[model samples]
Structure formats: structure tokens, C-alpha cells
Target: MIVPSSLFASGTESWRGDGRTDEFDSVATASRALADGGVTAVTGAFGFDPSGTAALIAPERFARGTRSGASRPLPAVVSSALTPSDVHTDRIRRVLAAIDEGVVDKAVLARTLEMTFDGPLDPADVFARFLPGPDAATTTAFAVPLDPAPGRADHWLIGASPELLIAKTGRTVTCHPFAGTTPRGVDAESDRRAVAALRASDKDLREHAFVVEQIVDVLAPLCRELDVPDRPQIESTPAVWHLATPIRGVLTDESITALDLAALTSPTPAVCGTPRAAAARLIDEVEGSRDFYAGAVGWCDAAGDGRWMVSIRCLELDAAGTGVTTWAGGGIVAGSDPAAEVAETEAKFRTVLGALGVDPADLTDRSRPAPAPTST
Candidate 1:
């Protein structure tokens, strides 16, 4: 697990062995484990669907350190996307229709790309490639081992995420949600223009407001005092620029753990959509199971202090270690352009594809018209 301030690596045995069973109350289970005094911290990942299974663990041993820049070259690989670009864009159009119909104000849609390596890929090495500098206060890189399906090899979820789902410390609660996005420009001048354009775009601003408003509504009842900026600021990563709003609150009930806050506020408009249930239903009909793609990952201590980062800019490695599936998504609103949305997901994919020595440009051909939508 990794946060901007620290990196933690854990091994040995989990307090209750593999904790990835079908639908259980993970937050409640962790609370009980912490209350029992068997472990100081509970770490792992929560799936995208709140009711879905989670891969949580109470580690027996763990080490903490600062972030590192170490990395190794990835081997040769073949890549394919699970969802075709045309199909994904067509889905975006469908979401636009939903927004027009007032089904939801906004929704996040994602696509996945799978890569198979020529040899076994080392999780540690791939993770190393994902780590950011210690000064990268806006980024979090993580590598969490997941429970394998019966008869399958060990699997892992790994990525460098730029959005914080939630963090808690003492009576303090914080969430930094990222919404509207634009690809980084090719030159310094173009980049500056891109930032300026993003800050002023009405469409982007509307998209961002949906995320901030939803988060504030969820957190308001739980906190005695909450601070939300009047406007979002530009948050830059190597691949894209995002409009981010940092929200902080003082909890009225210190008993509320980070996991609880996460459960309440996650799948925010940044990852899900406004009127979450309506958007989620639309997503399920189109994208099927998200697995853990847009889920949250982190550790919460017995003191109810911990951090969770949105599971974007991430990939899942199969048991054999050769197959990898990474996902990227964008929020869709009434003004969203289908072509631009497709490009946005592409820009998001660059965070991982570039690291793996893959040229993202070669992955999609835009000259041809996107094909009509079909069942997956």
C-alpha cells in the first residue's frame, strides 16, 4: 500500500487468511478485528460495487518507508482492448442520451486493455515502475495481492492513482476528488493553453461541480465543519491534467473510521455519477462488472486513521503473471463529446501503457468512423 506520505509492504499471513469471500461487511469485519486487538491495522482493497466481495487483510508484519524511483524494463508483450474504441464511444453517446433524459447528470465510463507478456512479469518490478517521487503529494501508488479464484494462480492489483478516495486522522476527514480532464499538451506553450482552457471550460466546470457537490452532500451530515473551495484547481500528472477539489472536514463523531467514510462517499461522481443509483444501473447494463477498477484501496488502523485512493490508472495481473488488464475512464455529461471522451480514456491509459514501453498512439485508429454499438 502507498500514499503520498508513506509506502507500506506487508507479507506473512492475514489475520483471517484470504478475506475475499463473496459479499460480506468488510468495514464491520475490520472494525471488529481492530476492536479485538489482534491487529493494529487492516489493509486491502474494496471492490467497485459496495455489495461485492473485498480483498482485505490484517497483516502479521509490515514495513514502512518513503517512496522510491526504482524500476526495471518490462518484457515484450501483445496488447488488446476488451472494449473496442467505437463501442466505447457509442456507449458514451448512450450516456449522453441518459443525461438528456434526466436519468443522471453525469456518469463515468471505462474501457480495459489487456497485455500478455512473453515471460512471467514480476509484480515487484512492475510496482517499482509505478512509484512516484516522495514529493508527489497528489499521487499514490499501490500493489495489493488479491485472493485467487479456486484453481487459479495468485493475482495482484497494482497502479499509480492520482485521486484520493478518502483519508482520516483523529477527528479529521479529507477527500480529493478529480473530475474533468484534458490530455497534457505536446509543448510548454500548448500545455499552458490547455490548463487555461480547462480552468475556463463551462463543460469541464459543470462536470467537476457534480463531483464536489455530491461529496459535500455525503460528508456534511458527518462533520461538524467542512471546507470546500469555491473553485477547483488544476492537478497535473505526467499524462493528463485534472480539475481537483480538496475537501476537508472535522468529524462530529470520531467513531467514524476512514473505511466508513470511504464506504459512504466512494463511487463518487468522479468515478460513478450524480444520482449514483441511476448511473450505476446504466453502467451495469453497458459495462457489466467493473471488478475493482474504480474501487478504493488503502489501510485503516484501529484508531480509525487511514487513506484510500481511487483505483484508476491501474491494472490487474492474472495468476499466471503474464496477462495484465488496465482500465481508464472519464465522466460523461450532457455536453460531453463522444470522440473527446474516447480520447480522454486514451490519455488516462497512457499512465500505465507508457510505463510498459507501449506506444498508446498505436493502440487506436481515429481516422475510421467508430463502428455501431453491439452487445459485449
Candidate 2:
């Protein structure tokens, strides 16, 4: 986890195993149960759907220090879209129509890409590629083993996320939510123009407002004093520029844990939308199960201090390690252009796609025929 002052990396030496919450119902209940059972720290992932299952564990021992693996050269891999480009854009158009009818103010639409390698892929190696230099502090890189579903094998959820869902230490809490997006420009002048355009975009600003408003609504009652900036600043990753607001507050109740805050604030307009339930229903009708793709991942300790990050720019590695599925998404508002939304998701995918040695331009090339859908 990346905190304001230090970076923490941990490896499990022994697993309590019993701490797994097969079906995550309530973060408060599950966390209380773990703490009652003497688990010092509970770590794992929460599925995207609030009612879906979660993979959490209590580690008996944690080995910490510098990250210990060298990134291996990724082998040639086959790539295919789980959700085709045309289908995704069509979904966006449908959402635009819904917005017109006032069914929902905004919704987030997502798509996935599957990459199968020639040989076994190492989760550590792939994760290594996500880490920046030692001094880099903004991105949080994670690799958590997921508890397999009834018929599925063990897998790992790995990513380098730029958004923090929530964090807590003592009575202090903070969140940095990102919404508006634009791809980074190739040249210095173009990059500056891109950032300026995003700042002035009415559509993008509207989309970002929904996210910040929702977050404040959720946090206000729980906070003794909240600080929300009037404007969003630009946050940059290697491939995209995001409109981000850094929110900080002092909790009214020290009893509120990080996981509790995460559960309450997540699925914010950043990933789901305003009137969250309506948007979620629309997503369900169109996108189907998100699994843990846009879920929250991180850890909570017995002291109720911890951090959780939104699971974007992430991938799930299959048990055999030969295949990985990664996802990207964009928030859809009334004025959204279908084609531009498609391009937005492509730009979001560049984080993991570039790390995998795939040129992101391949995703945007219209001359190339779309790959056939593949079974995960």
C-alpha cells in the first residue's frame, strides 16, 4: 500500500486460510468477525458487485522489505476482446439515451481484453512491470491471491492503481477520486493542450462533479470536519491525464474502519454512477458480471487503520498462469460521444497493455479486423 509517507510491501508466510469471506455481505460484519478472531490484518479483494463474493485472508506472518523480483520478458501472446468495440460503443449510446430520459445522471461502462501467453506467466514478474522507481509514491501496486469460485481455480488480482478508494489512520481519513480523463499527448505542446481542454470541458466537468458530490454525501455524516476543494487538479499516469480531487476529513467516530469507509464510498460515480443503484442496474443489463474488475482491494488491520484502492488498470491471472484478463472503463454522461468513449477506454487500457509489450495503437487501429470473442 502507498501511504503519504512510506510504501509498504508484504508477502504471506503463513495463511490463516479460515479468514476468507466466501460471500461478502457487510464489510463491518466481516471485519468485526476477523478482529474478534485475533486476525491482526485482513487482506484481499472485494468483488465489483456489492452482493458478490470476496477473497480475503489473515496472514499469520508478513515478510516485508524491498520488492524482490526482476521483470521477465513477456512472451508473445494472443489478444482478443471479451467485449467487442462496436458492442461497447453501442452500450454507451444506450446509456446516453437513458441519460436523456433522466433515468440516471451518469453511468460507467467497462470492457475487458484477454491475453494468453505462449508459456506460463509469473504474477510477480507481471507485477514487477507495474512498479515505478523506488522514489515513486503515487501509484499503489498490488498482487492478491483470490479464493476460487465453486468450479474455478486459484487466481491472482494484480494492478497498479492510481485512485485511492479510501484510507484511515487514527481518526483521519482521506480519498483521492478520479473521474474526467483524456489521453496524454505525444508532444509537450499537445500534452499541455490536452490538460487544458480537459480542465475546460463541460461534459468532463459534469461527469467529475457527480463523483465528487456522491463521495461528499457519503462522507459528510461520518466526518467531524471535511475538506473538499472547489476544483479538481490534474493527476497524470504514463498514458492518461485524470481530473482528481484530494478529499480529506477527520472522522467523527474512531470506530469507523477503512474497510467500512471503503464499502460506503466505493462504486462511486467514478466506477458506477450517480443514483448508484440505477446505474448499477443499467451496467448489469449491458455489461454483465464485473467480477472483481472494478472492485476495491487493500487491507484493514485490527486497529481499524488501513487503505483501499479502486481496482482499475488491473488484471486477473488464471490458475495456470497462461492467461490474463484486464479491464478499463469510462464514465458516461448525457453529452458523451460513443466513439470518444470507446477511445477513452482504450487509453485507460494502455497502463496494463503497454506493460505487456502491446502497443496501445493496436487497440485503436480500425483497419485491423476485431478479434473474435474468447472464453475466459
Candidate 3:
């Protein structure tokens, strides 16, 4: 077992898989092989966009299963943190225009902040120091390496995601998607008001329901029974509050694995949008490349059971660690505002920004250049 001790907190070694595939069936081939071997555990990541690829890995070295001393804090100085000013807003404006044109109902647009560190970064530390309080208990934190495929460098994807793409155990599956978002305020009263507003906001509710409905539509065909809540509950992280709904169902086909369920429901309305094909086209035309920003990441076992979380609030780091790119964004509907959407992206970047010792609030300045009309 080749365990790398200095980098990760767990000291585990995984064989990273490689390449992107055009179809979900290609991604499932690995998991099906593991299941045929009896009970086993495999883990890794895939991309956010449909045509993108995946890297599902099997662990060659395992953790010691022991706790260490108190975790260390992240670095305080940021060499540089930057985002494209008018570009982000312009992207959102175009998507909104599409919504008005009846091309799509909603689309989750994303923004990335690229940072150059003074030295190599330890992804494990990034995951550990982010949102380190009681409220973060529900979050799924990860730091894993991608396979060494052609044109793909040895990079690690790290972050804490609060949305569960899919989880399977026995013949049961669960999907919890979060859509509507409100930034948490510094004061308790302010925070409470924010939560209340999220629940009451018609736009937020509609955005949240689209995600729930998409998951139901995908799973209903494969499951014997399913349960979806009428309303979303407020799921809180240290930095933001979200409208989250947990959908549960029992798979009629025992042969169906967790990976299969994830493939079906991924790029859900929460991350992608409604009338998927239209939203995908808009994303391609407006947002450029998403890479793995909103993709699914986690593990599957030999028994066909596994867990995958929506890859949000994350960063991609080079193996050398000299650079990092953090990602965050939100759903854009008819009522979405350009400035408000910009602020929402900043809110989503809080966990990573905070860990990097940068004040996330600094990015919310509305004075940033306004987006020009699409004709420009």
C-alpha cells in the first residue's frame, strides 16, 4: 500500500481513473465490474457537464481509522483572488433572456475565482479548515485526485458540498437537492429574517420545486415507490441557507446501483435547469465550460451501494499546488436579478474564501460594472 502521509489527513491512497465519456453507460461499466466481484468500495469523481468525463477510483491504501491532534488553520494571505466582472453578469443576462424567450425555465450559472498561492496547497487542509463547526456536520467534505489521462494533469478536487446527488443501500435510494439560497447574516435576527424570506420568496420556491420535480421524474420509473415533500426545509451551512428537499424511494430492480441512480438524476434542475436540453444548450452558449463544477463525486461499493454528492463550493488544484480555482453559483429564473445573482455566487464561495483567509463579503460590491445588453 502506497500511502502519502504529508498531504491528506486520512493518509489513504486511491487509484484514480481517467477520461470523460459521452454516455452514462460508459461511466457505469466500472461500478458494475466492482459489484460483480462481491462487496467492495470504490470512489472518485466525474464532470458537471454531460459530455464531460469521470475518474472513479479504487483505494489501494486505506486510512488508519484514528483521530489526530487539533486540525491546523488555513493560510491567511491570498496572493490573488479574481473573477471576470461583467462577464458573469453578462452570462446571467443572456440566460434570463432565454427564459423570457420560452427556451428554458431555469439554469444554474456559475462563476470561478482563480487564486495563485505562495506555495503548494494541501487539499486535505482545505477540506478540514472549511466550515469547521457544528452546522457543517451535514456537509460532505472531500479531497481526491483525478486519473492521469491524456491532457488531464494530476489534479485534486476538494471542497465541502451540502447536496446529495444520490445514495444507495440495499434496494433503497435517496436524493437531496438544494436550490434556492440566501446568504447568512452576521446577527441572529438578521439570519432568521433571511431564512424566513427564503421560505416566502416565490422565485426561490419555484426554483427549489423544479429540482425536486426533476429528481422525482427520473427516479419514479426505476422505483417501486417514491416520496417527495411538498415544501423544502431550510438546510443551513456556516455561510448560507438553502431550500433543500430530501427525496426517497425503493428501487424495484435490485440490479440498479447507486451510480446508476446518480447518472439518471444528475445535472438536476438544482445544478443544471428545467427542460434539460434547453438549459444545457444555454449553458454551452452562455457559460462556457463548467468542467467538474457541478458534477457528482463520491464512492460506490462492490455491493452496488454508494454515495455521490453534488460537486459545488469546490476548487480544482494542480498537483504542484501553485494554483487553485474555486467555483460557486446559483439557479437563474425569470425573477433573478443580475446584481443579486452576482452576490449569490459570492455567498456560495464563502466556505472556500474563508478557508483561504479572504473575506467573502469583499466580493459582493454591487458597484462592479453592470452587465451590458446581450447586443453589446
lDDT of 2: 0.77
lDDT of 3 at 299: 67
On residues 233-298, what C-alpha lDDT tens digit does candidate 2 reach at each position? Answer: 998888899999999999999987888788888788999987998998888776777878888888
Instruction: Supply every candidate's count of residue pairs whose N, Cα or C atoms clash at under 3 angstroms.
Output: 0, 0, 2
Q: Candidate 2: deviation at residue 300, Å?
A: 0.7
| Tens-digit lDDT string for candidate 3 (140-179) | 6666666432344667778777888998999889888899
Candidate 2 Cα outliers beyond 4 Å, as residue runs: 1-29, 134-136, 148-152, 360-376
C-alpha lDDT of candidate 3 relative to the true structure: 0.72
List, residue by residue over 293-332, the lDDT tens digit for candidate 1.
8988877877888888888988888888889888889999
TM-score of each: 0.88, 0.88, 0.86
Clashes of 1: 0
Q: Of 2 and 3, which scores higher on lDDT?
A: 2
Assess the local accuracy of residue 292 in candidate 1 as a C-alpha lDDT between 0 and 100. Answer: 79
